[model samples]
Target: MTTAKTPAAASPDTPQPHPRRWAGLAVLSASLLLVVMDMTVLNVALPQLSADLRPDSVQLLWMVDIYALVVSGLLVTASALADRFGRRLVLLLGFTVFGLASLAVLWANSPAEVIAVRAALGVGGAMIMPSTLSMIRHLFTDPRERATALGIWATMAAFGGALGPIVGGALLEAFSWHAAFLVNVPVMLLAIVAGLFLLPETRNPRPGRWDLPGTVLSIVGMVALVYAIKHFGKDGPTDPQTWVPALVAAVTLSWFARRNLRRPDPMLELRLFRGPAFTAGVVTALAVSIALAATMLLLTQWMQLVQGYGPLETGLRTLPEAVGAAIASPLAPALAHRIGARTVLAGGLALSGLGLLVIWSWPGTLDYWAVAIALGMVGVGLGSLAIASAVIMAGAPPEKSGSAAAIEETSYEIGGALGVAVLGSVAAAFYRTHLTSEELAAEGVTGRAAHVAQESIGGAMDLAHEMGGAGARLAAQAREAFTGSLEWTSVAGGLLMLAAALLVWRLTPKDLDLNEVEH
Candidate 1:
């Protein structure tokens, strides 16, 4: 059983015993693992789910995007609730919800049911993430110790994200998509049991009552904004369905900001942005997320379509990237110490940009080893950014810790969605322009069928097989178009990363010791 020790009793100078510290690390890692695993686990399973459910486009989008949307929108509120209530209590409730939702997903036969369950899973994820970070904040009061703990935490998170596709591929081969959702059940249960036994209870001693209006406004604003972005990506900005929600979201968020300014106990204190380190960290998080998400989405398509790798093989090949990330994450803190956060962040971004450039310069002929090296560089850069950003956020005051963590997490979620939408659209546009008339004729795909196929890489693959000889030609052209698009996209990504490096170099402070800060 875990024993409650006062912060004074477990001072930074007088460290906790190795066993206790390691146990705490385990608890944090378990919570983070759940969060990271859920992020990408559904990707490989989406095809199977679509086949089983036969959802319409919108419903399918919801099935894929709702989890992230809900988690991103609710994170601030959930973190605040945890502070108001208790971290341990919130964690338990989250774990229970996640476990139950996993079961619901397994049992769900309808698209609507699956969407609802996925949304529930998002809520659980929102609750778990901030609490995990906050607990880490409390557990590792020493800067050196905290860095080590965070390294382990960051590695686990990266590993879990990479592991999702691999695990899903294995499950897909052996069983079905249902196995992917079901796998979470046993893991969640174990985490719950272990957390209850080993985790210490912590709470904000002076947390104010929950701000109902703030919560409502945040959720409504985020949902509206995300809906608008999704619609715009799918149908363009002039689409009434896209613009209306976006306009409404802007108005509501403005109102929310005004309301927060007036309230003494705001859900998220706007004052946190005054800190340059925190602000820089948030921007870095968002940019890194956009890069990672876009790269992964494109790389997966490239592997399966152009490279002709099966799902299992694609997953295995991607493991090198994860290994590189896992190795790099632990070195972040030391690098930061040697060169300062600003320098390290800038260098990391530059490395990422170079990696993307490598991909952009890749010849049409596929080279697995070269591709792997490029991807590994991208992973290393991201891993460094992830660890550094976490350290910045967790170093904030206890009262603001939850909100800070939420902001960082929100940046990632929104950035990821934006990346996919923007880069995916770019790819689609290229695919359309490059489609030869001969190719279309050969595939027996014309007009709407051809249009649909060009709109998405996945759709293209599906339509190609449906058509005959001509379809094969069309598919090859489409794949080549996608590769061309990826090359340009990578160039754009590299430029953005370089810009981020410059920004971080200018903005982040030097010699700031996170452990010395008061809650």
Candidate 2:
């Protein structure tokens, strides 16, 4: 009988620190930071963008969400493309497109034009993210060194996500919303130049041809699915418009998977899930992301609506979460080693659940310090999530690492969207059930006005401002209702995280060594 080769023995090259490695990391980090920052930077600029362009609500939603949608949709294909072509070449191309698209967005005069440019930016971002990680995999061949590198990469990603709102808010306060998009220009230019000089070309030795059909299928399926989910949450799941796209998405994705199962060189290798660690890691990552995404949305609203914080104040108040994550990033591997990844993940989830419970049980009187501490707990949980993802990718076969990374990212993007949609719907339903039309009318809301207010938490608050005494009463009621809903949501999130922890523990092998896996 033939013996299976081990990861360490299969591939003799183990990553060592080279002088140019840090430089390469710098380039990759900048690229990742830019892509992640773009994801949320426009949020602060949305009001300005709408005021300047006068877009409708749907258009506004598209502008806010389309970048993520497209990036998530195209990530699989982009990763495959990176493997087939050269990662460096792909990275540079993406940077160039992103820079040009940023300029286009800055100059856009109409909502349609802006949306178009944002979609283009998404395409560029998709190319950049997967390729950068794949390059990192090639550069850091040693599992331990790769883990360290991923920690830095993960830190940059988290920092960028945290800084986006603050940076965008500052830009908007000082200049215009256009500055938010335009800011990418210089960063992109610098990254492009640095990447060309410092980054090494990396590609698969036996890369398959670009699977165009699979690409189209994935894009259409993901876009349709996400759109359906968003519409379902905003409207109803039973709504024809919602179900129609969802049905189409399901069919297409199923077909895509079936096709991949038969193909020799599939765009995505479905067989990667044979490894229990990878499977458990993906599930843990997905569930944790869903909880975190939902928590972030609810917390933002709680700060602004309940605590009566301005945008800047809310941003500042949330800084502790980022700080906690930053402090924990470098320490993740150590913690993982000491406690084991399953235990660390379980503990992190437990901590996050406790944080959510704390917020849920907050007294009527606002306590900023308590809130900050809760947010910090969530941040620590997020750090664990990051570590889990790093472990998954590091544990994967090097040849299929790009696909593994793509799946990991896809889970996150999808989980985030699902969380916001599901939790937002729950909150909306509770808010409507708690508020009455009589109270709404007394607040200056009438006819379709009450209907619109019932549609969203923001709309409810806006309508409340119109109704004087009754509005004040209704606003208070709405706040209570929203908070109650959020409390339940937190419980659900906690349970989900707990379930994920158990799943990881059960599914992942106890003595599974990365050195034993096939490279």
Candidate 1 residue 330 C-alpha distance from true site, Å: 1.1
lDDT, candidate 1, 1-519, per-residue tens: 123333444456554533466686797797688668777767767767777788877898898789878887888788888878888789888888988888886678899999999999998998888788777766665555666676677778777878777877788778877778888788888888888878877777777777788889898888787777667767788889889988989998898889877878777776677788878887787777777676776776687777887667777878877887887777877777676667767777888888888877876654677678787887788677655655566447766677777777788788887777776566656666777545665667778887667666667877877766646766777787887877777877778888888887777777655444344
Kindly report which residue stretches of model 1 are placed more than 4 angstroms away from their true locations once superposed. 1-19, 436-443, 514-519
Q: TM-score for all predictions? A: 0.92, 0.91
Best by TM-score: 1
* lDDT score at residue 147, model 2, on the 0-100 scale: 63
Reference-based lDDT, each prediction: 0.75, 0.75
lDDT of 2 by residue, 1-519 (tens): 111122243244543434477678878988898787777676556656765787867887788668778887888888888888888888899999999999986568998899999999989988888787778787766565566667778777776777677677677777877888899999999998898888888777887777788889988998888888778777788899789999999998998999888888788877888878888878876887677676666766676677777556766777877887788776776677666666766677677767766766777744677678777887777666556666677566777778887887788788877777787677667677777777667766779987867655566676677666667766776777677777667767777777777787787777654323335
TM-score of candidate 2 against the unseen true structure: 0.91
Which residue pairs show backbone clashes in model 1? 398-519, 442-470, 443-470, 443-471
Residue 394, model 2, lDDT: 55
TM-score of model number 1? 0.92
